[model samples]
Every structure is written in structure tokens, then in C-alpha cells.
Target: MDVPNKKTVLVIEDEIVLRDLIVKKLEEIGLGTLVADSAQEGEKLIKEKHPNLVLLDIMLPGGMNGFDLLERLKRDPILKSTPVIILTNLSTEDKTATEIGAIDYIIKSNISLDEVALKVKNHLQ
Candidate 1:
């Protein structure tokens, strides 16, 4: 049930290098991308763009963190269905992430950029 022109992924990360790498990788794979350096901006983008998926970082600079944003997204009727993948170095367990409604948890240090692209591809499919 792929909707025409409905492929976009929003990335919420504060790290410049990692965020750029992710944006590049996701774009190279042909998925549209939107980015936010903090959860507040991410929330705004999510409301405006309605991206198909989200790559969320646990720690953020603004008042709200990724976990808080995740909880809010899960509670929202419109956003609850969007797939979210936790992309962070935080020690938050996979169980916790899943319980919070994240589709997957990815450790930035453990996976290559291409591997991240692969995971995104799998989730998008």
C-alpha cells in the first residue's frame, strides 16, 4: 500500500557529523529527508511534514528529549502510526524502546552508515 509521493524520513539528532551522514545515506537510498537538531524542531517538522518514519536520538538540546517526544507521538492519534527507530548511543534497552512504541533501536557506534540505510530500507518496506 505505498502511497504515491509518501516517502519521507525525519531525523532528530544533535550531532552534526552523524546527522549529515544519516541524511546523506537516506537521501542516497532515494527516501526524502527532514532533519532537526533537537526534539522541539523535530516535533514541529513532524506536525508540518508528516514524514513516513522517524530516526530519533535519545538526548536532545531543547526542553524535550527524544523519549518525551516519542511518548507524545505515541499518544497522538495522527502520529501514532508513524514508525520510529531509536538511533542513539544511550544504554536504554531495546525492551524499553519497544515498550515506548519504537519499531527498532540502533546503536550509532555499532552500525555502519550503509547498515543504517539497510535498516531504514527494511523498515520502510
Candidate 2:
């Protein structure tokens, strides 16, 4: 059963440890979460769930990287408005990610789990 008025965040990250930690922190803050290990899975979840926001990672295992997904999302009429935050290790791609339509770029190593959750909360509000 879905909870009424609850905001859901979709996290597209392949790292098991980081993904689990992100989900844990989000849950602790009373937000609903859906996780995907790849850009393909993330796209499917975004289409099906219509999450309020997305925490996307750049280095996915599948053929499509985060940039590809972000490009596709921005191009899609229905999904273009969805907020996406790029969470990855690549600091050099920040400009590219913003240009591609990610609302924010977070370098994974520079931020804490609490900060990530806080950012997500702020975006949802």
C-alpha cells in the first residue's frame, strides 16, 4: 500500500554499500525510497513510480551512464520536469551534468550521508 502524501526518491547507484547507506538515511528521514542499480532500471522505476526526486549516479554498470539517462530524461516530454541530482565520484563532470539537466551535482566523496538526506529533503520540499 502506498502512503498518501509521502514523497519518494529514486536512487540510481550501482555501489552496494553506498546505495544501502543512502536508502537507510532517506528512510530515517521519513521519506520513501526506490533503488536501481543501473540507468536502465532507474528509467523503468522513474516511468512506473513517478518519484518526486532522483539521486542518480554516473558510473553505472549498464551501457547507459548517468549522462545518457539525464539526456533522455530531459528530452522526454513527460519526464523532463523531474528533478535529478547527480551523485557520483566524477567532479570533472559537474558542468556536463548540469548542462544535461541535472538540477544538482554532488560529489559522493565530499558529502556525508546526512548531508545527502538533507539535500533530498530540501528538494522534496
In the range 18-92, model 1's lDDT, one tens digit per residue, is 999999998888888988999999999999889889999988897898889999999999989989999878655
Model 2, 46-124: lDDT tens digits are 9999999999999899799999999999999999999999997978999999999998989999999999998889888
What are the TM-scores, per candidate, against the unseen true structure?
0.93, 0.96
**Stretches of candidate 2 above 4 Å error?**
1-4
Worst 10 residues of 1 by lDDT: 1-10
Q: Which ten residues in a row have the lowest lDDT in candidate 2?
A: 1-10
TM-score, candidate number 1: 0.93
Question: Cα deviation in Å at residue 21, candidate 2?
Answer: 0.3
Model 2, position 57, has a per-residue lDDT of: 96
